[model samples]
Each structure stands twice: as C-alpha cells, then as structure tokens.
Target: MRGVVMHAPGDVRTEELEMPVILEPTDAIIRVTATCICGSDLWPYRGAEAIRAGGQRMGHEYIGVVESVGGEVARIRPGDHVVGSFVASDNTCEICAAGYQSRCVHQVMMGSVGTQAQYARIPLADGTLVVTPGELPADLIPSLLAASDVLGTGWFAAVAAEAGPGKTVAVVGDGAVGLLGVLAAKQLGAERVIAMSRHADRQALARRFGATDIVTERGEEGAARIKELTGGLGAHSTIEAVGTQESMEQAIRATRAGGHVGFVGVSHDVALDGAEVFFSSVHLHGGPAPVRRFLPELVDLIFQRRIDPGAVFDLTLSIEDAAEGYRAMDERRATKVLLTTD
Candidate 1:
C-alpha cells in the first residue's frame, strides 16, 4: 500500500509501504476512501517541531469503509461506511464516559497511526467509529470527513467558549477549524458572530457561515476592532484556532471581562500574561478537541444535513499528489487540501 512519509523537515513523500493488518483484539482495519492534510501536520513539516522518528506517516482526518475487524469488535461490520474521530478512544472509559475522549487514558494519536494512506488500522473501533446512515450522497463525504476533525475542533471550541443565544461571539482564525467555529457558533445560537479574517474568499464564506462581522486587523489592532464592533464591551465568547502566541493573546484580549476564551489551537511555548488574564476573569479551556465525544452528534448532523463544512476544502488532489497539496497550503494558495485513494 502507498502512504505519506515525512522523512525530515520540509520533506514529505508519497511512497509504498506494507499495508497495516489487524494487530489487537480491539482493532479494526479501514480502507481509507478520503483523507486530507491538517494544520497540525504543518508543525513538523515547517520544522517548528522536532521529528524524533524519521519514518512516520502524517494526517488523521478520514472517512472510510470497514474492511475487517478484530474478534472483540462487535459494534460495526464489513462494508460499513464511517467517519472516525482522530483519537482512538474507548468511549466507555471513565474519561470518555464523562465526555472527555480526547483525554482518554488509552487514546492513540492518529498522527503516528497515520490515516493518509490506502488503509488505516483503527484501535477502539466501537468507540472511535461512527457509521454513516445508509449510503451517503457522493458530495456529502467531504463534509462528513471534516466533522471528524476540523468541524469537531471548531464545535468543541464554541462549546468551550459558552456560545448561546443573545451572546456576542468572536472567532480568532479563518482556517478550516476557525471557519467551522463560525458555523458552530451560529448553530449554538450566538446572536452576533465576529470572524477575524483578511482573506476575501474566506471572509465571504465566514459570512455565509453566519459571521456577523469581519475584523481584518490582527494582534492588538484586531482586539480593539473586536471591542469596537461589540460596543466597547468585547465579545462574550472567543474561539482561538491559531496556536501562535500572537493569535492566542489577541483572542484573550478580545473577550470581555468574565467571558470565556475557547482555545483549540495546538499550543506552543506560549506564556500568557497572568495579570491581564486574571483581571479579565476569562475562563480559558481547549485541547485536542475531544472529537470522540462529539462524533456521534456530528455524524447525525451530517446525515440530517444540518451543516456543510466541505467548503473549507478549496483544493482536492489524488493521494499521490500529497506533496503538491502540502506545498499549496504552505504557500497559502489553498485553504485546505483533500486527498483521495482508490
């Protein structure tokens, strides 16, 4: 089977490798139908993070058909089309049972497990996979796959930020996760949603997703703009999707006192101003998006046509063109890239 291999910094290749087989009692093998590049995949690709392992696959977001299952797997069967959460979690565990599957004690990181391939070996099948309702319309697959990661991340961010009716919400990024945050905020009943974005194309979609305002400035200026749009009180809830220090600070500073800041961006060595944050009385919370917790609900939304997140995918390429997809994202020529395998 062919898979993506990250050999080193600024180096990724589409190459042939042995297909993964069922290795554990709780495992299931999935024939990946669609997969895509994620922002998190950029960390190591740009040399921002060290790659301790030379040979490893990239990507975690995917939707596929179940090809086989281990003896312990009883919830799903062969030929089932499904969308899976990035975290390989047993949803019945204590943490998962409490709606924190991203922090599941025995969770497996999909980056290392690698979904950017012809097939994927999934652990905790019953807990991680959500079967699609019957046969899905062909065009809906991309949106369902987005729910597995970016959409889920955005939804989690909105939930953390306390979005609801009569509240003003602000989204601090315009990528796939941030764009979906706009959708999530609207669905959660936020009266006014502000999206900080400069790209005309993304801004247009943000508006379509229910963003009430668009702030073109970044950093301090952006914070002031948000407050100005909110009548000087700032937003009641803010979602941070970019993990950079500037992005995080901008998000914190844009929220009103006693507001909640939902930060879903993968954090770096960021040190927040303790005094400023304390004075704002902002409640900050976010992590690897407990995707497993929302998988079923999000899947149901897809089956029922409640949301369409596939718009974020501006470019689609064959699995073999993974390099061009990465290059397109790196060059800012594409918002998000999708990969398909036969």
Candidate 2:
C-alpha cells in the first residue's frame, strides 16, 4: 500500500508502506475511496507545528468501503460505504456523552490512521464510522467526504457560537472551514451572517452560503466593520476559524458584550490577554470539533442533496500527487484539495 509521509517541513511524499490490519477488538479496516489534505496538515508541512516523530503519517478525513471488521465491531459491516470522524472516538465515553467526541477518553486521532492511502485501520468503528444510505451518486462523494471533517467542524463552530434565530453571526477567516461556517450559520437560522474575507472567490462562496455581508478588512478595521454592520453592538456571535493571534483577537473584538466566540482553527502561536477577554465580556469555546456528534445529521443532509459543501474542494488530485495538493494549498491556488485512490 502507498501512504503519505511527512519527512520534514516542505517535504511530503507518497510512498509504499506496510498495509494496515485490525490490531484491536474495536478496529475495522477500510479500502479508501477518497481522502483530502487539511489545513492543519499544513502546520507540519510549513514547520509551524513540530514533527516530533520523523516521517509522520498524514491525513484524517476519508470515506471508503469497509473491507473487514473486528470481532467486537457491530452496526458497521463489510461492504458498507462509510465516512469517519477525523477523531476516532468511543461514542459511549463520558466526554462523548457530553457532546465532545474530540476529547473522548478512548479516542484516537485518525491522522495516525493515514487515510491518504489505499487502505487504513479505523479504531472504534461503531462509534466513529457513519454508513451512508445505500449507493450514492458519484458526485455526492466529495460532499459526504467533507462531512468527515471541515463541514462538521464548521457546524460545531456555529453551534458553539450559539447561532440561531434573531442572532447576528460573524465569521473570521475564509478557509474551507470558514466558508462552511458561513453555511452553518445560515442553516442554524442566524438573522445576519457576516463573512470577513479578502479573497473574491471565497467572498462569492460565502455569499452563496448565505453571508449577508463581506468585510475585507483585517485587525481593528475588521472589528470596526462588524460593529458598524451591527449598529455598534458587534455580532451576537463570532466564529474564529483562523487560530492566529490576530484572527483570535479580531474574533473576540468583533463580538458584542455577552456574545460568544467559537474558535475552530488549529492554534499555532496564539496567546490571549486575559484582561482583554475579561473586559470584552465575551464567552469563548472551541477545540478539535466533536465531528462524530454531528456526523449522522450531516450525512443525512448530504444524502438528501439538501446541501453541497463539496464546492470548497477546488482541486482534486490522485493520491500520488499528494505533494502537489499540499503545494496548491500552500500557494493559495486552491481552497481545499481532494485526493482519490484511483
């Protein structure tokens, strides 16, 4: 089997590797049909996140047909087409029971599963995998794949932000998750959805996703724009999808007092001023999204053709071209890149 390995910063290669097999009672093996590069994967590629283990395996989002299941696995069986959460969680855990599957005590981050390959092992199969209804249209594959990560993450951000009727929501960042955040806000019934994006292409998608306004400004100017649009009250809720210090602060400052800020970006070099947060009177919450919690509903939406979040995938490449996919995203030439086993 061939899999993506990050040898070092700016160096990712798809090379032949040992195939995976069930090593746990709760494990299942799947032949990957589709996988993709994630922005967080860039952290190591760009040297922003340290690769403590050299030649670390890459990728977490994937969808495929189950090839085998462990003795303990039930509900998911061979030949079922399934989408997995980025985090492999035992849904019955206390943490997962509290709606935070990402922090499940018995969870496994699928980045190590190396979904960017021919076949991979999925632990906690019953809790982590959601089978799509019957056979899906070829075109719907990408959208269902998005539900494995970005779309679900974005939806979690919206829920964390308390987006709902009568609420004014603002989203900071214009990446795939950010774009989906706009979509989630609208679906959640936000009265006004503001997308802070400088890119024309992203702005267009944001609009199509129901962004009521687009603010191209940055830092304080961006915060001011949110305030102006909300009549000096800022937004009732703000979604921070870019994890940078600036973006985090901008998100905090863009929310009205008593509002909430949900940050879904993979944090790199971020430090918050406690006093600033105290004075802002804004509530903050977000971490790795509990994608498993929302997978069922999102899968239903995609299966019903009610939403097409796959539009965020601007580039599709063969698994062998993983490096190019990374480069396209790094160079800002693609919004999101999808990889196919074929």
User: Candidate 1's error at 332, in angstroms?
Assistant: 0.9
lDDT of 2 at 204: 98
The RMSD (Cα, Å) of candidate 1 is 0.9
Q: Residues 233-322, candidate 1: write the lDDT tens digits.
A: 889999999999999999999999899999999998788889988898899999999987777788888778888888899999999999
**Model 1: which ten-residue window has the lowest total lDDT?**
49-58
Off by over 4 Å in 2: none
Residue 28 miss distance in model 1 (angstroms): 0.3
Clashing pairs in 2: none
| Candidate lDDT values, in order | 0.91, 0.94
Model 2 gets an lDDT of: 0.94
Model 1 segments more than 4 A misplaced: none
In the range 89-120, model 2's lDDT, one tens digit per residue, is 99998899999999999989999778999899
What lDDT would candidate 1 get against the real structure?
0.91
> Would you estimate the TM-scores of all the predictions?
0.98, 0.99
Q: After superposition, how far is residue 3 of candidate 1 from its true place, in Å?
A: 0.8
